[model samples]
Target chain A: MLHTYLLSIQDQDPTKPLESFGEKLSYGGQMLLLGMATVFAVLCILWACLVIFKMLFHDLPAKKTKTADTVEQTVTEPVVEQTDDGEIIAAIAAAIAMAESECEHVKFRVVSFRRK
Target chain B: MLDAIKNFLGTTGVAQLFADSNWWQYLVMYVIVGVLFYLAIVKKYEPLLLMPIAFGMLLANLPGADLIHLDFFFDDYYISVEGGKIVGTLANDFTQFLQAIPNALYSITDSSIVFDFSEATLASAGTTMDAVNATFQEFLGNAATLTDGALHIKMSHVIKEVINNGGLVDILYLGVKLGVYPSLIFLGVGAMTDFTPLIANPKSLLMGAGAQLGVFAAFFFALFLGFSPMEAGAIGIIGGADGPTAILVTKELAPHLLGAIAIAAYSYMALIPIIQPPFMRLLTTEKERKIKMTNLRTVSKVEKVVFPIIVTAIVCLVIPAAAPLVGFLMLGNLFNVSGVSDRLSKTAQNELINIVTIFLGVSVGATANAENFLKPQTLYIIALGLCAFIISTCGGLITGKIMCKLSGGKINPLIGSAGVSAVPMAARVAQDEGRKADPSNFLLMHAMGPNVAGVIGSAVAAGVFLSFFA
Candidate 1:
């Protein structure tokens, strides 16, 4: 079965010449036109499909952005803890100092302290 | 002892070369092999494939090393079988039939024969089995009738012969002949390829298609040079700038020219850096080259996963003949982008591709024996192959210029040359030229869009040829 198939591929003898130069030329021209045309058409269709995909999936990244904003909000909220009042005051002062050092123009202060 | 020494000397390769009339051909082949080795090892021009191919050529040309017998594959060799018994050889020509009959009889009876027959009787008879059998009956007088008019030689018989009598390379060559190795290589290529750039910018696909201008151009030129249509089609595919695609097409359309076409395709591909730059510069102005366009949009994971599926469906539907090459290619790509089959993807990308490359390179190299490679037409194929590469670069550049104009100078004309499908190499050349025009202008990612698209484009072009001619 394998040999039969291999032989079938070889059946078209490459040595056999066509009848005339005119026929060869005509065939060559036709193939050139047909080959180029088919390639362009197929790729063009693929291009159109990609364009549609972009449109369909356009909103996905935006949804991802909304989730990212919620994560940011949760990260920025302060955590409450049972501790000494003095320790809390000292922690706030150190945090303000670090923030002020990073941004030289900004001044930070503790507005209020509560035990929770 | 003296007689034994004489016999040994008579069987040696040196003795064979001295006795053969065409000894110079072998010497020339050796020099060609040496040059290829120098290119592969010293120049570092696709060393992985070129080294194996060069060595295979050397092995084939060795005087006394009967590593491959081209006649077994060529010459329309066939055998007829009847009721599971080996019958007579089926050859259209009387001379070939007569030459093959002895072997056929030996395979069947497992005994030697001393038979006499007049050539005049067989020559006068027609080539049909009935006519030949009648002639044989007259010679043997009472021998049993042979054959059932089935003309094909069973592949099993050929495989048995290869295992029993053929060389190592012959066994390996079956993969190339059956069109298995190239497609498998594409599978690996697909696993390694990233279609993100192409997916991000879909317009690059048109540039890829435009770059195929050289494929048809070379086809027409080859036809004018007196190659048969099939041979021309095989030669023309060298323009695709993809070696496996060229090899698969050539093996199917013109197996005899595989060696020449393969060598030409690879050598020209290695020379792309030199061959494409002049055309890229000649076709596009400085202003056009410096045009750094907007960045490609980010392709979502969902789009990446769906890209290969859509391409495979549309391309296979449009050109069914392209399915083997294109289907395997997309399958490989899917394995890569799907992100689920990491193990299968890794194996295809590394071990599978490497093994097939060695087999494909060497077997394809084995086809370049003295008679096939040392022809005036080989020179034509080499020249036409260079022309194909140059024209393809120009094709891409021209399309790039048109796209630049149409998009109101938002596109860089330099990126067009990447559509010739030399992968990242062609794209890098575009980036280099673009940077020379303006240091800050980056075209690598932009050019990659067209570079990957060119891979698909060339595969489609190969399918078109197969559909028309195969």
Candidate 2:
């Protein structure tokens, strides 16, 4: 349909002068010119699409990000001594150190109490 | 010494100083330039351009000022260095060089060296700047920017060479050559127009056609008043108020009458509301003026897209001469209607229209040089243009009354006046007047049918003129 319409337009008023090879033409010539114009127009659209996509995806990410509330709570809230795997391991190590320190203190305290 | 100074102050005294030379002629020119500046600044008529043009005219007229004509110095090449040292002679004779250089060798040296003349074609194609370098070499013969360095062109030598080769030097100052810039302007015009309005309201095509009543009416009036057919046609188009169309028609039909026709058209177009309303009101009564119109039916997207294509085929087939104006208008409208390309349409309506309006305004204004414009016939053209506009308004309003009667008062007679194709201006006037009668009445959309119709009516009228007279 488009091709037929364009052909009909070109066919209208074919009184073009022989000398008017490159002379000023009417609207009919302009319509035919747009057929060729579409090619460059498409190329321009493609270029614009690439630029927009690059802007969307390829730029550097933000330097500072706001942590989600859940993650923030996990990191900031102090763990109870027996809270999780890391806390439990630290608790165990602390208990062992306390036992060793208390061994000397306990013997001395007992001796003192007995002597008293 | 005192007598010489006194005589210098007097009229015959100044004439005696130049030995019967016309010195007052120089003073008169300065006076004219001064008046132009005064009018530009005080009246604020086209201040943006007229001020600069007037200043340029003054500076150019100053004895030994030699600034604007510095370009003329480039017309003839002179050897110059950074420190004003003379160098080898330069040549600006592009055509002569082309003639001398064998086409075969020249093509090898630079296949692009030959003038294409198609850059102009491309510029019209809306492909601006691709061929600027080629344009500089071939058409202008002037180098690109002066940053390219001090250029030399041997004008005297080129003239001698041309004479030796039996060519004319008048061809060198082809700066003001005929047919080049005007056509390029037409190209720019073609690139910038949208034809969708005429397409959307195909019935409004008659409005444009109807508006050209003024063109033909003015033509016959001018002819009856002893102007030639060409002059008559040129004057008649002034009512159309289309600058490029006026330029194209005049350039073809009556190149000499371009100055008057252009001034009358632009001036009247600017004064559309003031010039057209009285005529509209005078022809119709207050009751007819206050008639309300219904809202325009919503146009479909498909219909909008199809409009430009269909109108172009139908209108151009019928009247080939109107193809340019109608084509551009429809094209501009097409851009507007094409939902996929809002950017292009916005550019056409905003940037392209703005830029072209400025150029079209000033260039046409400048063409109204003193000698061409200061004539009894120019006054006649202006008066006839007014009559044409009034008659067209009457034609539209009376036709609108007929439509109103035919459509059983459904059609507003006021909108008939807008059929003069001042676009939304006349339509807005109708809407304004309708609102005055009844506050809730909104006639703007209704008025647009005929408003857009007026543009087509005028183009069809121009085509009719072209068919019969051009």
Candidate 3:
């Protein structure tokens, strides 16, 4: 019954000002119901689509397994140790010196090597 | 030399104000502008937009500044064109038509015509039909025609006049009137917002929709208060708690009410941290407030990328009127989530939105001249806007309570208030309340689901109003 009223109200031109108090009341009521219903309906449809997206993209477990497998392989793999090359060490020192020269107000020394 | 000095003095703003009967009104406007400045600066309330808006008000109210002429935009004149030429005698609605003629001339010629007629020319022609006709004939020349096909002049034509002759702020106001700035701001909001929580819990969208209670409720109240349907719709949108959406809806539905509605919407939005918490506590039990739901699942990159696309298609399909706002919003989100358009995303989120915000704020502010801002309806709008915000908060809380019961006490009702869509502020209030209740509960992520959903919900509500009224 309310649906029929909504349909009827929808047909009326909303821009026209309601002259009678009762007509304005009725129209306002119709607008409230219609506006709420439409807002919910649109969002609900979006909600349903998101749910479908969740179902379609349910590859989380597969991706997790792949990541786990990579971790395992990395742990089992042998770590290669390399002796420091004099040329590379000297280049790194020169770069640090250049940087230090640019910021002459600050003094610093290379304390240790860290891999990030 | 003495006569020339006296003439210049007569033309000064001080003399104009002294001669005008409504000088007190300008003083009142200055006080209001000062209050707005205090709110924007000292109180630190939404200052990014508020400061510009207040300054714009100051500009508009300064005596004899001539910065904005509201009469230029008034919908009082009609154009009758025959064979692509204007037909009306200048004597008929001539004063009103003078304001519209530049625009009409631009429309017909497809180029702006400089209106260089001296004030003396207009004054001499005065209300004499033959004299005014001769003046128009001199101006229009071959462009003038005589017949009768009446058509209401379009707003675009009105805007053309502003472009040709309106002051700086008046030209900038075109963005608000044409519905450009709001949609662009939405694009930036989309880029900045994260939809992960919403994607993890799609049901949160319902809570967002529930929060719209205030909008429709306010509309009903405004209508009961004897505001026209268009005015009521504009008033009701203050509940959306989304500033751009309110501005967009008000601009289209009731441009006359734009200043009052924009002030109400933004002020209420800034006050959300204060306005929403009481309603939140009143609507939910301490037990319901402490009930923390499980953590949301991590949304994958693929899902995030697909979310905006799917939402744009679904929403625009259902409510095509929402396409301008929703479409740009999704496009912005897609730019952010796509992970490949970092520069574009950064620009939209920062530079583009900032520039548009200044333009949107000041122009909207310029609309609030003494005549419009000092009205009784402005007070009604402010009151109704507060009612809308409170009711919306309650609506979200009520929905949260319902969902809590349905979910067997897994959902915390406090998070529901975040559905009012004041963005992170509403979500933060929910978190603050949750922490006070349980000391360890973290509702921020959970609340965000509904927080972002409220943005979409409000946009959709605006769309419904546009479809109904625009």
Candidate 4:
């Protein structure tokens, strides 16, 4: 009744197994443990293969910029300040100055000097 | 005129019902059919299959109805198969059996020729009466002879029987008895499925595998409750939550239990939304439920094409008994993913599958004759089916929680409940619950991974059960 990776071959009479309750449960338990393990093993193999394939073929990670690296939490969004329009720059500067005036020690930068 | 009236009254269904001593069976059948009809129609619970099934149940259970009736070997209609050997199979083919012997019902004698059909006896002694002894002996040797000149077989109504008196449901029941319907249904399922989600996240395969814990668990419970192992195997498959698989396994293992087992399985499938949520919530934290799965990576077209072939090779090698259902399922998928065979795929999913589904549902439903479906065992099947379904969802959710923990909160535990193979229905329930937790979260595509995995997992489970006899 012990479940193993190799497929167990049972040629017991179908009717005989039903005759004894303990024997049926033993059969049931064997199937349970073996079936689950087989399922997990098969799926895990596929998962591992997928991970390896992704690692070998997917685009390489982009270099982390100073601004992005400074962004402390994965939950936080990176602030970008790049624009061709003067009006957008003024709006960004106004917002940054407004926040900075409250906390004088705060420092900020326009990470991208080109048009976004 | 009075004699004609009496004869006509005697032939009427009402007259037959009145004369029948088993009136309670009729009453119970009517009530059961009525409830099934209400569920399939009034409540719209899997009406596509259930309504036909309900109607078929009604037809088969009616007193004096020819539909689904077993024509016993009485009235001198005799058929005996001795050791399943046929003495004159070449001489008495089914075609000759169909033609009623051309006014010459010949009997086999122990003579060297094996039949006494000489003109000497044909003229003086028609020999049909005295030949009964010889006929019975040859019958034991698998030569079927009818003194009444009707084609005699056990549970096999011939083409002539169909032309004369066979009902439509009886004709359809052949599909169920021969075990063709479930595999055809799988073909339809394959054509309709998109396995990208599964290919994208193979880890969900474990969730599908985890979900089958219900199947094994329920099997032990059923056996403990004193069901025969075959009967327990049928009941246990309900935990797989795939209607076709349950029906197929029930048909193979315990055909007498098919009607009850199928109805219980499909009823639970229809009620997946109601049955799954409480377990999903009970098994996981709000934080785990709210976890958003990363978007599935797009699978290459080549991968989709290769999947079915690989799965078939691996699974069939392991459990050959599952090859028919799983093979047809993968063939349907191949027809779909090949992209050049839209017509083939459409036919499999829509036309071919639909035709088989009608036969499968009605015929399987017909087997719930009053003598079978009215037992306390039927109630137990229903109760155990519900238990299996709930516990299966729990199994999936428990696995999902573990995966969620291991994946650093990327995997949503709610998607675990989708591992039961009720198709998009189980996935939809997960989606609906996820939306309630976080409106921005969409769990459908992610849940689909486990949903479809449940299908493959259940088929493998069925194969494991069938391997015993195979």
The numbered model that scores best in TM-score is: 3
Evaluated at residue B183, the lDDT of candidate 2 is 36
Instruction: DockQ for every model, please.
Output: 0.23, 0.01, 0.27, 0.15
Give the CA lDDT, 0 to 100, for residue B235 in model 4: 87
The sequence of per-residue lDDT tens digits that candidate 2 reaches over residues B292-335 is 65433333455556555666666677567767766766676666
* Share of reference contacts kept by candidate 2: 0.00
Q: Model 3 over residues B1-470: C-alpha lDDT tens digits?
A: 99999999998888988788888888888887888789889887789888888888888887789888766665432334445444443224433445534332223432222233345444553433344445555544333332221223457657767887789888888888889999999999999998988998898998999999999999999987778888899999999999999999998888889998998898888888789888888888888888877867767788999999999999999999898889989999999999999999999999999999999999999999888888899999999999999999998988888999999998998988999998877887888788779866767778888999999999999998988778
In model 4, which residue pairs have backbone atoms overlapping below 3 Å? none
- Candidate order by decreasing lDDT: 3, 1, 4, 2
Better of 1 and 4 by TM-score: 1
Candidate 1 residues A3-95, lDDT tens each? 553344345444455567776676667778778988999999999999998988755866896798688875775654534443344345434
DockQ, model 4, C-alpha based:
0.15
TM-score of every model?
0.79, 0.53, 0.80, 0.74
Instruction: Kindly report the fnat of each predicted structure, to 2 decimals.
Output: 0.59, 0.00, 0.66, 0.34
lDDT (C-alpha) at residue B421 in model 2: 67
Ranked candidates (DockQ, high to low): 3, 1, 4, 2
Report the CAPRI category for model 3.
acceptable
- Give lDDT for model 4: 0.73
Candidate of highest DockQ? 3
